[model samples]
Target: MTRTALVVRGGWDGHQPIEATDLFLPFLRDSGFEVTIEDSPEVYRDAERLAATDLILQSVTMSEISAEALTGLRAAVAAGTGLAGWHGGIADSYRNSSDYLQLVGGQFATHPSTHPDARHGEASDNFLDYTVEITDLGRTHEITRDIADFTLHTEQYWVLHDDLIDVLATTTHPVQPYHPWHRPIVSPAVWTRLWGEGRIFVATPGHSPEVLQDDNVRTIVERGLLWAARSE
Candidate 1:
C-alpha cells in the first residue's frame, strides 16, 4: 500500500519552516509516500482529513494549538499513525499545551550564549563546533543502523526531558568561556518514543540549513520518519 504523509508547517519564520520542509519532500517521495503540504495548523482540527494520513510531519514551532486540534492529533497517533519533527519544530512547539509536550517528550531549555566573552558582539556570534555522541547502541535500531559517531558545527541543544524517551544519541558541552553559568552537561540529540500505538522520533540538531543538508543527518532523519511510521 502507498503510505500517505501530511507535512504541516507554520510558525516562527526564523526557523524557515517552509524552507526546511522543502528539503525533506523529495526524501519522502523517494520513500513512496504521497506527500501533502499544509501551511497552517488548522489541518490539525480536521479529524476526517487526519484519519486518512499515515504519518504527520509537523514543522510548526512556538504556536498555540487549539485543544480540539491537539486532541485530534493525539487520537490519530494513538490509532497507529506516526508523528515526526526536528528541533524546535517538535520540541518547542505548542508550549501552552502540556498534552503536546507529553507526546513529543522534550523541550528546548536554552542554548547558552555561545560567546559570552564578546564584548562588542552578539552572544550568538560565539556559537562554535559541537559533536553529538551516540549512546544506547544496543537497540540496533534501523534509525542508527550503520551510523557512525559524527560531529556537526551546530547549536547543541540542552533539552529538559522526561524518562519516556529511548535516547539514541547525545552531545556534551563542557563549560566554556562563552557559557560559565553551567557545568559539563550531556544532552540527548536524538530520541524516539512509543505513544500509544504510534511512534515518534525527534532530533535536536538542524539549527542551520547547512546542518540539515548533511548526508548523515539527512539519512538518519529520513530513516527515522519511516521507522516512526512503521507499526512495529
Candidate 2:
C-alpha cells in the first residue's frame, strides 16, 4: 500500500519555504509516497484527513496559528501521524503557542551576529561555518544511520530544548567577538522525539534550499521523512 505524505508550506519568504520543500518532492515521490501539498496550516483542522495521513512535512516559519489549527495538528501527532521538518519550518513556527512549542521541543532563539557591526532589530551577518558531529546514537538511528558528520556554512540555529528528546547530532559554537559570551555552547543540530505512538524528526540545517541540497542534509532529511512515516 502506498503511504500518504502531506507537505504544508508557505510563511516567511526569507526561509524560502516553497523552494525548500520543492527540493524534496521528487524524492518523496520516488520513495513511493502519495503526496499532498497545502499552502497553509488550515488543513490541520481536517482531523479526519489528518488522521489518515502517514506523515506531515511542514515548513511554516514565524506565523500565528489558530487554536483550532494547533489543536488539530497536536491531536494528529498524538494519534500516530508522523511529523518532520527542518530549520524554522517546524521548530520556529507559532511564536506564542506554548502547546505548539512543547510539541516541537524547541524554539528559535538567536544566532551569533554575522555582521561585525550589526545593530539591534537589524539582520545579523551571523552565518558561521560549523561542523555537525553525529552522535554514536545517530550512527545506528534510522534517520541518521550511515551518514558521517558534515560541515555547513549557514545560519546555525540556537534553540531552547528539553531533555526528553534524543539528540542525533550536535554543534559547538565558539564565543564570537560580536556576542557577549565567554564560553562555547553546544546545541543539537538534529533530533527526534516521540509523541504518543508518532515519530517526530527535526533537522536544524535547512535555513535555505542550498542547505537542504547539501548531500548529507538531504540524505538525512529524506530518510527522516521515511522513518517518521514508518516506511523504513
Candidate 3:
C-alpha cells in the first residue's frame, strides 16, 4: 500500500521553507508516498487528518502552533505517526512550546560565531567549516550506515537535547581563544527518538536548499523519512 506523507511548511523566510521542501518531492514520490502540502501549522489542528497521515515532514522555523494544534500533533505522533525534519525547520521551531520541545527531544540553542572577531550582522558570522562524525551506533543504524565522516562549510547547530534521543552523528564546536568556554562542545548532528510507537528523525545540517542537497545530508534525510514512517 502507498503511504501518506504530509508536508507542513512556513515560517522564517530565511530558511526558504518552500524551496527546501521542494527538493524532496521527487524522492517522496519515488518512494511511493502520496504527498500532501500545507502552508501553515494550522493543518495540525485536524487531528483526523494527522491520524490518517503515515508521516509528517515539517519545515516551519520559529513559528507558533496553537495549543489545540500542538495537542493534535503530539497525539498523532504518540499514536504511531512518524515525524521527520531538518535544521531549524524541526529543531528551532515553536520556541514558546515546551511540550513541542520535549516531544522532539531537542532544541536549537545557538550557532556560535565562526570567528571571535567576526561582525554579528552578516550571515558568514555563523558559517563554519565543521565535520559531522558518525558514531558507532550510526555506523550500524539504517539511517547512517556506511556514511563516513563528512565536512561542510555552513551553519553548525549547537543544540540543547536530552538523553532520550539516540544520537547518530555529532559535530563539535571548538573553543576559540576569544570565547569564554574552556572545553570544546559536541552536539548531535543527526538523531532519532522513539515516542510511544512513533518514530522521530532530526538532522541539524540543512541550513539551506544547497545544504539539504548535499550527498550525505540528502541520503540520510531520505532514509530517515522512510525509517520514521508508520509501519504497514
Query: Arrange candidates by lDDT, highest first: which order?
Result: 3, 2, 1
Q: Which candidate, 1 or 3, has the higher TM-score?
A: 3
State which candidate has the highest TM-score.
Answer: 3
The candidate 2 region of ten consecutive residues with least summed lDDT is 115-124
Model-by-model lDDT, in order? 0.83, 0.88, 0.95
What RMSD does each model have against the real structure? Answer: 2.0, 2.0, 0.9
lDDT of 1 by residue, 1-232 (tens): 7788999998888678988988999988888889999987778888888878888998898988988889999998888889998888888898988899998888988865555445356535635578877785613878987787788866678898999998898888788765555689888889999998899999988765677888878887888899887452
TM-score against native, each model: 0.93, 0.94, 0.98
Better of 1 and 3 by lDDT: 3
Counted clashes in each candidate structure: 0, 3, 0
Candidate that would win on lDDT: 3
lDDT of each residue in 123-230, candidate 2, tens digit only: 336677889999999999988888998898888888889997899998888886767879998888899999987889999999888889999999989988988885
User: What number of backbone clashes does candidate 1 have, counting pairs of residues 3 or more apart or in separate chains?
Assistant: 0
Model 2, C-alpha of 82: deviation from truth (Å):
0.5
Q: Which tens-of-lDDT digit does each residue in 1-232 have in candidate 3?
A: 9999999999999999999999998999999999999999889899889989999999999989999999999999999999999999999999999999999999999998766567678887889899999999999999999999999999999999999999999999998887778999999999999998899999999999999999999999999999999999
